[model samples]
Target chain A: MKKTKYRSQSGNAFLVAVSAVILGLIGGAVLMAAIGSNPFMGFYYLFRGGLMNIERIGNTLATATTLMLVGLSVAFAFKTGLFNIGASGQMLIGGLCATLVAHKVFLPRPLFLVVLVASALIGGALWGVIPGFLKARFNVHEVVATIMMNWIAYWSIYYFVPAYLKGPSLETESASIAISQSLRAPWLTKLFNGSYINYGFFIAIVCVIIIRFVLDKTTLGFGLKAVGSNRWCAEYAGIKVNRNVVISMMIAGGLAGLAGLTFYTGYSRNMQIGVMPAQGFDGIAVALLGASNPLGVLFSSLFFGILQSGKGFMNAMTSVPPEIADSIIAVIIYFTATSVLFQRFWDRIARRRGSRRADQREEE
Target chain B: MWSTLSSIFPYAIAYTIPLLITALGGLYSERSGVTNLGLEGLMLVGYFACAITIRLLQDTMAHSVWLLTLGLVASVVAGALFSLLHAFASINLQADQVISGTAINMLAGALTVYLARLISGSGNVRIRMGIIRKNIPFLSKIPIIGPLFFTQTYWTTWVVLAIWALSWLLLYKTSFGLRLRACGEHPSAVASAGVNVHRMRYFGVVMSGALAGLGGGVILITYSGEFHGTVAGLGFLSIAALIFGQWKPLGILGATFFFGSATTIANVSQVIPSLSVVPPVIFKIFPYVATLAALVLFSKKSAAPKASGQPF
Candidate 1:
């Protein structure tokens, strides 16, 4: 009976997420029509662009890799009641560390991969820890702290990239990493028909599994969630609230760092100095739509991945702007933020159905 | 050094006006018990609206001043309209204010650019005319103060300063202001007193949207003559200022000026020989770092409204 209740609760959450997505899609359709384009054609081309062929499928997964990691980062942070909006900055620092490793470290394949991944993890963790420490010690708001940290990272890279890793001509981006040094495996690339799918996809999957395990099976996860639900209560329960906050932030930051590693090293193969990775912001939407669950994040990110990866093609094939994808994401997040409306609606329906069933049972 | 300071003073003021107005907007929302992180997006909506209005009207209107005014009005209207979504979610739906604010930012950023691309075919709207900078006669000649404050100023700068002054009065000297402040600190008490907390919050959010839009329009007319679908994180910077200022109008004036000077210095450092010795990164990161420091200093006795992020 307990298990069934839990299943039903989870089912309710799923309905809320689905409702949000449907509303978001409808919002996108309204926008498309407002701009005088046929919404049907725009969506048709949009989906086709994402799943039309093997290369596109590979591209979709490649894009989803970064989103997956960032989504996990955000979802993990949300579990601890922290908003790690600084994921973009964390990603930059992590990608920079990973990029540096790709450029300078000439180890054997397996060892090189270890160093690359570790560099990003540590870099992201360090970035995450500062805001966490501030929140713990000074009771500072993590949202503002992370935002400041992001700009600090931004300017640091604005100078750091040009000064050190600049490509020969383009001053705006780091030098491209060689295919051998990047996250790309030759076999996988060939299998995907030369698409940018890399080992990062596998890394993201491993992280999802690990995160799920930690959240469901570990005492630390319980402590973090306890702290999240109520800091004062968590303290009363003998959990170290401050310590959990810091640790949760660290893990979240590290996940975002891995996202950077995948994005800069695995996918783009170079880091652009001025561009704040939009994936950081999109991760919030991913976390929201997924209800901040690890498996939920995985599927929602793939859904967004299709929208993002397909947007350019949709633009080329139809008059719909590629930004429609971003607009859809934004609308979805708005709906998710207002998911209380959906929750109340669903509960009313469920209660009505239960009442009807009880009446039938009484008659029998 | 004095020459360099004098040279950059006008530019610094130009930069500060937009930030000041936007931060003031944030002040209203936060003081009314709603933490608005959507200032950046709201500013963009205004910026885009102003740009589109100006682009469409510039050719037809004989007077650039009237055209600019129309553009700014459009921005204010658009920003206010856009903020209604945020107000609805937070007030009516009892949504997570931060997430709702984030959604506002993302939506404005995307929707503005999407529409801009369709209208202009370049995702950028450039205006042919801008408000020319002019020195106030006689005031410009008054010693060191004149050179720093009154010389080579855009009229929009003075106009924004007037709004800032007016806002200070409205927030501090009015009965409605007391009620609004009460709503942020203890909404139940306000409700008990027969003041509608939700209505006050809506007014605060709407005011924020209008001022932030005006701020965006100010930026378009005074310094930036184009709309590239972004205010380049100035909205966020203004938010930082709002926090740094401890949610006070007078405090915001000072904070925005400090940030404005830092930004101007960062932009011109390479050309200024003595200043060039200092790494540009220092000036670039100073405002954010200072804001963090300010947060640490204020956390124990935080002036933030008690119910700011709380849903009543």
Candidate 2:
């Protein structure tokens, strides 16, 4: 009976997620039709673009790597009942740190990689911790604080890149890092037919496993979840709610930092000024769809990665703009935000099913 | 320094008007117990709608003034309609207002760009003409105040300030305003008093959408002649101003103007010899940094609406 109850509960969540995705796709279709584009053809090219060749698959995975980390970052915060909307700012700071390390540091390859990754983690954590600290100490809203942090990072990059890291021709971007210094693994590149796949994919997988284990098996995880469910109750039960909030934001920021590292050094091998990585906000959709679970984030990130990686091809093949992918993602998030509508629909179905089962038992 | 001050004053006011109107919109929403974090998105929707309306009518219209007036109306309508999505989710659907607002922001950013790309094929809509800045004849002749406030000002600036004044009176001096504020402070009590909490919140949210949309339209007419799919974070900046102002009408006026001055100074510092000694980044980041500082200082005794962010 307990197992059935758990199954049904999971089933309800799954249904909600699926419905949101369906509605979002329909919304995208309507948009496409309104613009006089063939919706079916657009979607076809979009999926094929992400999966047509081994190289494309590798690119998709490479894209998913950054998204996965960002998703985990958002999901981790969700677990502690905190919203880390400053992931973009955290990513910028982390990427800046990683870029610095890539340019200036010259240790042995393995040692260099360790330092590179750690720099991003620390950078992201520092950025994340400021808002966390503000929220904990001063009761400031993290949402507004994070928004401010995003702009600060944006303007800082606007000046810092031109002053310190200007590339050969463009003043808008940093100098590219050499492949050896980047997250590129020769073996993986060769395996994927010279695609952009890098060591960040492995890092994402490891993070997923570690996060899963921590959330399910550790006392710290229990305390965090307790605080998330009910902070007042958790405080009464001897949990340090403020400390948990800070720690949660820190870990979340660190994860987002890794995302930045993977994106800047591994996928692109450079950073561009004036671009707020949309992946940060896309991560919110991933976490929401994943139901804020580690495993759920992994799969959802991969799904979004396909859409993101495929969009350019769709635009090339059809009159549809590449922003269709983003529009769809946004629609999906809106539906997810209004999931209470889905909950009612699912509840009504469950009630009917339970009543039918009761009738069957009476007949028996 | 004095010459620079007068030279910079008009631009400062131009920058402040958009933020002031948008932040005022935020004030209404928050005071009515809904945290409309999607003000940025709503502004974008207005910005886009105005751009499209003006773009379509520019060739057909004889007078630019009438064309611009119609464009602003389109923006207000589009903004109010778009905000209904946020209102429905946050109010009727009982969704988390912050998440819903975030969704609104993302949707506006993505959807506007998508539609713009389809319409213009380049994702940017450029207008042939913008609102001409002119001196208020008699007012411009008033020694110090004239040159600083009345000269070279966009007509939209005065319109927005007029709206601000009217909003202040409506929010402070009316029974309806009292009820709206009451809903934010104690919705249950307001409900018990026979006020429709949901209806009042909807009105507040819609008002925010209209004003924020007008703010976006003002930005396009006054300084930006192109719709390039972004307000460059002005919507978010206005939100910070809303907070800095502690959700008050007069306070928002001051806060937005402060941010506006900082922004104008940052923008023009490259050309101004006296200010060029200071790094442009410091000026650019000043408003955001000050907002964070303001939040920290005021959080101890925050005047945020009591029922704000809570779904009715």
TM-score of each: 0.98, 0.97
True contacts kept of each: 0.77, 0.72
- lDDT tens digits, residues A102-175, model 1? 99999999999999999999999999999999999998888889988988898889989998999988999999
lDDT of 2 by residue, B150-258 (tens): 9999989889999999999999999999999998888999999999999999999999999999988888877999999988888899998998888899999999999
Question: Interface RMSD (Å), each candidate?
Answer: 7.6, 7.9
Could you tell me how far off, in angstroms, the CA of residue A343 lies in candidate 2 after the best superposition?
0.5
TM-score of chain B of each: 0.98, 0.98
Candidate 1 has which clashing residue pairs, if any?
A: none
Please tell me what DockQ candidate 1 reaches: 0.59
Instruction: List, residue by residue over A1-364, the lDDT tens digit for candidate 2.
Output: 0000001125678888899999989998999899898999989999999989999999999999999999999889888888878899999999999999999999999999999999999999999999889888987877788889989998999899989988998989999999989999999999999999999999999999999998889998999888777789999999999999899889999999999999999999988998888898999999889888899899999999999999999999999999889889999999988888999998999899999999999999
Give the true-structure RMSD of model 2: 3.3
DockQ, model 2, C-alpha based: 0.57
